[model samples]
Target: MKNLFLFLTLLVLSVGVNAQQNQIQQDSTSREKLDEVLVKAVRVDADSPITHSNVDKEELAKRNLGQDMPILLNYLPSVVTTSDAGAGIGYTGIRVRGTDATRVNVTINGIPYNDPESQGTFWVNLGDFASSTESLQLQRGVGTSTNGSGAFGASLNLLTDAFSKEAFAEISNSFGSFNTRKHTVKISTGLLNDHFEISGRFSKIDSDGYVDRAFTDLKSYFLQGIYKDGNTLIKALTFGNKEYTYQSWFGLTAEQLQQDRRQNPYTYDNETDNYWQDHYQLHWNQRLDNNWSTNIGLNYTKGKGYFEQFKEDESAAGFANLIEDDSDVIVRRWLDNDFYVINMNTTYKKNAVEIISGLSYSVYTGDHYGEVIWGSDLAPNTNIRDRYYEGDATKNDFSVFSKATFKLSEAITGFVDIQGRFVSYKTNGINSDLVSFITDAEFSFFNPKVGLTYQANQNNSFYTSYARANREPNRDDFKNGVTEHEILNDIELGWRHNTNKVALSTNLYYMFYQNQLVLTGGLDDVGSPLRATSGKSYRLGIEADASIQFCNSFSTSTNVAVSSNKNKEFKASIDGALVNLGDTNISFSPDLIIGNALNFFPAENLQLSLLSKYVGEQYMGNVDSEFSKLDSYFVNDLNVNYEIKPKKLFKSIMLSALVNNIFNKEYVSNGYYYTYDDTWSDANAVTTIEGAGYYPQATTNFLVGATLRF
Candidate 1:
């Protein structure tokens, strides 16, 4: 498969090279329009009734030193980010509107990026992806119908760097706290004879994280070839990463945190996670006529990895016929998977009406296995590479959607969307617990959405929308005995006001759910969160954001969100009995989140900005116990950027720096809570004992970088 992909890539490059000899003249306007078509099916226009935010390359570059994408987006409205290593380089996660990453749908150039079985986006697998992105759009709430998993909380879509018209080369290097460093090199062939272009990037990042024994090493690359003529565009791209990170998922307990905040519990020398993933994509866009256009996308992804661990006093039966009843052992858990996807979409725009229709299909296969490499005692029949537990899974997903927009009148616009999705999942074999685990499930869902926009005047616009979404349980959810599908009904109303120096947006949302899968604050063996079905829940909130230019040298951007999240008539199993919790707060849902940025443009070539974030206290479990509460935190950062244009030997020289947690406040951003019934200690009456663990954030850190472009 790898050879086939390589051959196809070479073929596309050859075709582009051969066509470049003809000296074809291209229109920049047409090229821009064609580039937009690649992601139009999964995105919304500014005039649409959806609530969204757009981030471009220029905005991302200021803090693009070495952090992951989630950390760069931390200042966005209603966003919260966490890093397992106490820094922003490895094993990072993001939550929006109090919803976890698994509920966020992600796409790259209209191809699904979330894992099929887990429905989670692993940013570590695509290290330094922000360097290759041209622009990204984040839609809050169930705003639109998209491919792969349903959008329960938000949808994020990214477009890779566009082909350049002139040849260029760039080198970037950065060094920061925690012995962290990054090196990057990029080159572009530009438009050869105005018909072809090629570009590529390579990056390496290393960090000795703030936490003890938490280190990361990453290497990644991106390559693409493009051919354009008239109204037709063809692009072939490939991107991948290899990562090795020390284990840090096991967080610190309260008592241990008090003793030492940076201590690591695991002392084994070889405890680490190693993974590699690669993606291949081909996109073709054509304009059929003046009012018709179409786009086709194909994607193939291959992933394989393993994490090693040392177990103490494992059971003989668990190790598959071990000679001793209790012995120490070292094991490795592996996951190998293959995914293929195809997407097709067509658009028609004429007069006051525009319509878009698309279809997406995907197939995924994975093998899950564990092997016992070394044991304290072994039987004569035991081989060196004997498998202890093994399993395989297959999943198929298909969807069809159609959306339309109509200018009902001079000031009012109407939108409608409909989608049908079908999925089938099957798995078989023994689980790691030495028990049989088999599953075969199928689901068919129909979702619909409608909205209206009213442009009252040149500076004021009002919009309202309602949407429905349904999602199936992921692999870990199934393992935790949760089998029911979840459903959400969402409604949003907003108003936008724009002028020369001020831009403001305010919105109200009410989301009602049936059989919602809420996090239980408990992690599985591999650190994936466990979830359970809540009978009924709702989230009601008001969000406001603004960008104001006070004068020629100063400006400000700010956003705030206040919400009420609850699980109505909640129930839980207490000491050997069921208890009604009665309208408890949902886990991990904070009431208030605020973000602000104050920018100063002292000169045309220099800029300075101060960013701040505040997150309110929230419960880690649905029961709202004092033990599950995470304290509120307020943090600040400072950023500076300076540019110099040279007349000779270079196009530009850029210098950037960032100081995080400037106040040096020690805070914990994420944690887990769990309860277990103790029957053995108290035979007469069972007692439910509660405990919690926390992940601490770095106190103060800095990163500085310089880029030379020619």
Candidate 2:
């Protein structure tokens, strides 16, 4: 015990000393124009729609290289970023207002990016791809009805930079905290006879996380060609790519964590996994008439990746004898799986009313393989079921959507949206011991939403919207002795205000989960979620965000959210009686979250900034017990930049430095099911089997970068 204590003390001291030597730079005082994002709303309106918040090019430039797009979103309020690297750099994640990425709708050029089956966007699939993004927006709540699946938490739309009209070239280099570094090169071919332009960007990022064995190597490229004249425009844009990362999904027990303070932190369901992705899109825009316009887009994404994990001690936890043969070889197997998706969209716009509609279709398949992975007779992998041949399982999805906008009065505006989704699933290599679920179970729903926005003057606007979202069981839900069904309804009221110097927005939301897949308080190895069944849940929350320009030299922005979540009245399987899920917070959902950014400018060609982020308490499960609760914590970041132009060659350049997590706070941002040491003996089932989970947060780090434009 004394030796363990001494080791932890030395570890903390080492981190602190290393952090001090690498304190992030804070040295400049100027601001550059932020990037301008383009979305479906832009094609339908004269300016950015009321539902979106723009993170312009300026904001994107402020972030150090190798930082994932999710981490860059931290400047906004009501948002939190979780990292496997222990410092928001390498493999990171973002959640808005208690909703994780799966609930958030992501679109690229008005096309959906979420997997049709899982409805989750894996940003790690395209590390540093942000280097190609010209602009983007995060539209909270049910934003204006546009094309694609649905916008539950927020709609993220990104616009890739179009071809530059002038011929130019530039290079950027940055290095920082956690042994992170990035190098990028960009070039543009000037317009040909004032009709066509082409541009491309190539970038690479590498990082060794603050924690043990967490490493990231991401590389990507962006290419675009455009032809435009007067009112017609045609363009081809492509961006996406490859990443190699060390696995960090194995969560530690409370004792293991406290005992080995410098161990690897976990943030995902799988460990020791690495993957890749590549996508391509083509689009065309035209002005049909003065007040009427149209945009047609098509997308094709090719995704092929798998995550692997190292099982510690390949023995079953429960019913071990049932899963083994008479010889008692004690067989065990690991999981290696792969999948893919493809999609397309189109839209039309008019003066008083607009119609944006499109169709999307996706097909997915995967294979699980390894040694003799054990399974009890009740769900054994005989017939090579769990170990399906490295091939595809046929699962398909189809969706169609349309939305309309109406101006009822000078002070009032309304929107109506409708959507239909259809799904068909089929698989053969499922575990032979489990039900064959080989049925073509078809599920569809008519999702309709109506919203009213009243302008109570330019300083304030009040709005209300309601929507019902239905999700059919995906292939995963039915793969291993499991099935799920449900309709998730969301109701919201919001306010918006803006002026030359200030902007503010806020919303109140309530969500009802009709049939939730309740966790049965049991977890499988490697943490891919497993659940039994539950009846319902209710989540209520309020989120507010604001931006201000204090004179010409300073600007500040703040975002915050507070929420109350509880399981609805339901009968428990144990007692067969109605009971609350307790005051337990939802897993990974923080109750009170806040973020603020301050930009200071004391002179021309220079800028200095500081950002603060706070995340409140949370519970990892429905019971909300002391063991499942995660305490609250805050983090501060500082940045400085200076602009300079060489006497010859490069005309303009900016040099910047940033220090993230200046205070070095320690907290748990995410958690998962864990098993006790004793459970290891059974290799299957044990009497003291219990629930234990864990997730860790970030640490202090620093970075330096340079930006140049010609």
TM-score of each: 0.95, 0.82
lDDT of 1 by residue, 448-562 (tens): 8999999999999999999999999998877777788999999999999999999999999999999999999988898888888889999999999999999999999999999
Sliding window of 10 residues with minimal summed lDDT for model 2: 28-37
Candidate 1: C-alpha RMSD after superposition: 6.3
Go through the candidates in order and give each one's C-alpha lDDT: 0.90, 0.63
Candidate with top TM-score is 1
Off by over 4 Å in 1: 1-32
lDDT by residue for model 2 over 1-710, one digit each (tens)?
Answer: 33334433443453344334333232110110111212554222312223457776767887756688888887675677777666555567677756666567887776667765556677777666677777787876655544444555677888777556688887889998767888888888878888888888888888877666677777888888888765567778777767777766555678877876447754433344555566766666665443333456666666655555433332332222233333222222322333333333333333344445545555555443333333333224343223322223555666656666768898878877666666676666433232344546766666777778888886888888887776665445666445556667778887888899888888788887877554433445444445544467767888888889998899998988888866655443222334455334456567788888899999987888898988888766555556666778888889888889888878678798888778887677766642333546666644333466555665677889886866
lDDT of 1 at 537: 98
Clashes of each: 0, 24
Runs in model 2 deviating more than 4 A are: 1-38, 41-51, 146-149, 265-271, 308-350, 365-391, 431-439, 480-482, 517-526, 530-533, 570-584, 674-690
